[model samples]
Target chain A: MDPVLLLDVILLLLAVTTAITAMAIRDLLGSVMLMGIYGLLMAVIWADLFAMDVSFTEASVGAGAATILLLSALTRTGTRERTGGDHHLPALVVVLITGSVLIHGTSQMPAFGDPQAPAHIHVAPHYLSQDIGKVSQKSSDGATRRDFGDHVPNTVTAVLTAYRGYDTMFETVVIFSAGVCLVLLLRPRSPLRREQADE
Target chain B: MNIDGHLIAALLVLIGAILSMIRAAAGPTSYDRVLAVNVFGTKAVMLLAIIGFIGDRSGFLDIAILYGLVNFIATVALLRFVETKRLT
Candidate 1:
């Protein structure tokens, strides 16, 4: 097999294995640290796949921010616990059924990197072939040109900020709401505050 | 650079995830569970980036960066709130 394919297969296996292990460890803090390491590794995998932007994000958010937050939360709470108990039979059955369905569905998919696949022929080709100057052109060939000069080179940014800006706006609002909700839910009661005031 | 190294790395991560999940599920303290969940979130971010790479979509990297910033801010805010119990 070609080296690239071999590398991909190896990386995939590594990712799956780490995911499983992250879910199983007994030490909470240790597990969190491992998860951060996992994120860094995953970032490398993303780089290998030519998704540099994604790798950067993963490394920053997954490896840095999220891990710190979790650790802080632990400091407030404390860490000590059992692993788990017997699995629920029903949940197991559901998982197995879902896995089977997904595996079966794979047969209908275009083989990886198949040039003839609709994904390669349609949207992607348009992006790949188009130059920046012709983004607004409506002609069949001209339409393919999507200029990055006016926007970001990152497709996700374009999609999020341009094509789906409204959705992102709403999502940001939702995040803000969550922050508010957490504050409200966890805040001390007014009565308790008043009592402290009296003291 | 054998593929086996990558595979081993992923396996290690999976093992870590399982461990975190167990902590989340059986943690005696709220903090313990929170920590575990945080670990899970981190792992998920990494996973998304990896999947994007595997799919050859470099654009997904932008999303990852945004997510990272948001995640950090949220965590810090939560920690502050927990400590001060006020929107200071």
Candidate 2:
């Protein structure tokens, strides 16, 4: 087997192991730390797969900021394990069925770089070949030119800040709402007011 | 597929994820469970990014970024709420 293919297989196995261990650990704090390790390893995997942008985001948010926040929460609430009932057999069966379906579906997917998939054909080529402009005009040679109006080369950025701007706006609002909800839920109750009411 | 460096890295991450999941399952305290969940979210973000790379869809990076931001903000909010609950 080629070295690259061998490497890919190894990575896949590693990913599986991390997932299993994360689920099996007993100590919550230790588990959280392991999760951070998992994120970092995942970032490395992304880099290996040539998804640099994704690696950046994962490393920053998952391994860095998210872990810190979780630790803080742990500080607020003392770490103690809780006993629970046995796993439901029906749920396990359902999950197994779903997994099988997904695995089967994957068999029909296009190979990694077949070059004929719709994902490669329709979107990326247009962006790569054409220059940004206001009018979608064809050149004398019959090639198409895109209207950028002031766009960056990063297609992801264009999609987020322009094509899906409205969605992003709503997402920001959602974040704000979350903050408000936290404040409301966590606010201290008034002891003096309660005493007066009792009188 | 032949085995190599990327695959090894993936294996390590998967092991970590499994460990985190176990912690989540066995957490004696709500905070521990929350922490485990947070870890899971982080691992998920990485997994998404890795999948995008493997699939050669760099465009999915935007989704990963958005997800990361959301996960971080949610974690922070949860922590703050927990603090308040403890104080009260």
Candidate 3:
């Protein structure tokens, strides 16, 4: 097997193992730590796939912010999980069904990195061609005026900011709202206030 | 088969990561698990840097740096959480 592909397979298998163990473990602290390992594995996988932007996001958000947030939550709640009856059978059946359906859905999709894929045949070519800096802006009378200087070379950034501006805007809004909610929920208690109340 | 040096390096780092994962999953002590996770993060940073070389893209190094910083912060947070019951 190709080494890069082997690396991908190993990382993915490790991720699945950590994920399942995280769910099955009785110790909540261990489970959370396993989740941290899983996040790092996923970030590596994304980097291996050459999706650096996504890898960066996973590194910062998945392995960083998420682990800190979960640890804080665990601080409030005890690290030991309460014993619950084993009811794995039903969940296993549901997971199997969902996995099969998703796998079946993949059959109709293009192969990995297929240059002739529909996505590549459409506006993607136009967007990629913009790297040449040939993009021209039209004046009020519909005549091409000045060349749009140095069209963004990074296709991912261009797509996020230019082609799909509204989508990216909404995503930022969602993230901002999530941060606001976290601040409201997890803000530190004022030590002076508590001391005064005790007095 | 022609083997790339960078791939070999990445594979080695990946092996280290898998071992760390094992320790993280089944470690007897919470500190052991925490250390395992931190080790895994370091391995991940190394893997990313190696793969960046293989791909000939400088952008992967940016991600490697991000992972490195995050790993440090997360390890400190986990250690603090273990030492003290509260994050504050």
Candidate 4:
């Protein structure tokens, strides 16, 4: 295997191992720490795949935000998982079946880094093309940007902010709403105010 | 030097991350797990930087910097949670 691919496989296997270990551990705190390790590993895997923007979000949201959230949740709940009772055989069988099906599905996909892959050939060339001087402030009777100064050197930023403008906007709005919901759910009640109201 | 330096650095960081995961999985106390997690987080930052150098894209370091900041904040949050039941 190529060195880079070898690295990817190793990192991916390690991530899976940590994830399984996280699930099996009885101590919820230990499980949380193992999950943090898994998230950090996932960030590395994403970087290896050349999706640096997605990797950045994974690092920030997965390793950082998720770790803090899980830790806080542990504090609210007890530290250890309750022992015994639940059976694992059925869940394990379902996971194995799903894993095999997914593996079979991936075989139909193009090899990693295949230049002729539809994902690369379809619209990527157009996006990468430098159309610097092409212009008209309102050729289509709608306010739209012409080719500005440069083709966005980083296509990730351009695709997120330009090509998928409304998609990104809606996603951000959804995230903000979730944050507001969390504040509403988790915020401590004002004890003195509640007491005064009762009287 | 060639890209080998960056590749070597990345490989070494990967090994370090794996070792830290073992420590975390086997740790007897939450404190030990926290220490192991901190090491793993640092290794992740180094790995991202090394991969950035290998790929010849300086923008990858931008993510590494974000990871570094987040790792520190998460470690602080974890420690605080351990010290007090409430993360306030």
Candidate models: Cα lDDT each: 0.61, 0.63, 0.83, 0.82
TM-score of chain B of 4: 0.92
Q: Candidates ranked by DockQ, best first?
A: 3, 4, 2, 1
The superposed Cα distance between candidate 1 and the true structure at residue B66, in angstroms, equals 14
The better-scoring model by TM-score among 2 and 4 is 4
Off by over 4 Å in 4: A88-133, A136-163, A189-199
How close is chain B to the truth by TM-score, in each candidate? Answer: 0.66, 0.73, 0.93, 0.92
**Candidate 3 per-residue C-alpha lDDT over A63-92 given as tens digits, one digit per residue, 9 for 90 to 100:** 888898999999878899889767789899
Give the candidate number with the greatest lDDT: 3
TM-score of each: 0.51, 0.51, 0.78, 0.76
The regions of model 2 sitting more than 4 angstroms off are A1-12, A76-78, A83-85, A110-131, A134-199, B1-88
For candidate 2, give the lDDT of residue B47. 56
Give candidate 4's TM-score.
0.76
Report the number of the highest-DockQ candidate.
3
Task: For residues B14-85, write the lDDT of model 2, one tens digit per residue.
Answer: 567667667665667757866875776666566555555555567656656755665676566556645663
Clashes of 3: 0
Tens-digit lDDT track for model 4 on A63-154?
A: 88898888777765898899995788989999999999999999999999999999999987766664534464665667666565435546
Please count the clashing residue pairs in each candidate, in the order shown. 38, 47, 0, 0
Better of 2 and 3 by TM-score: 3
Q: In what order do the candidates fall by TM-score, top score first?
A: 3, 4, 1, 2
lDDT of 3 at B49: 79
DockQ of each: 0.08, 0.10, 0.78, 0.74
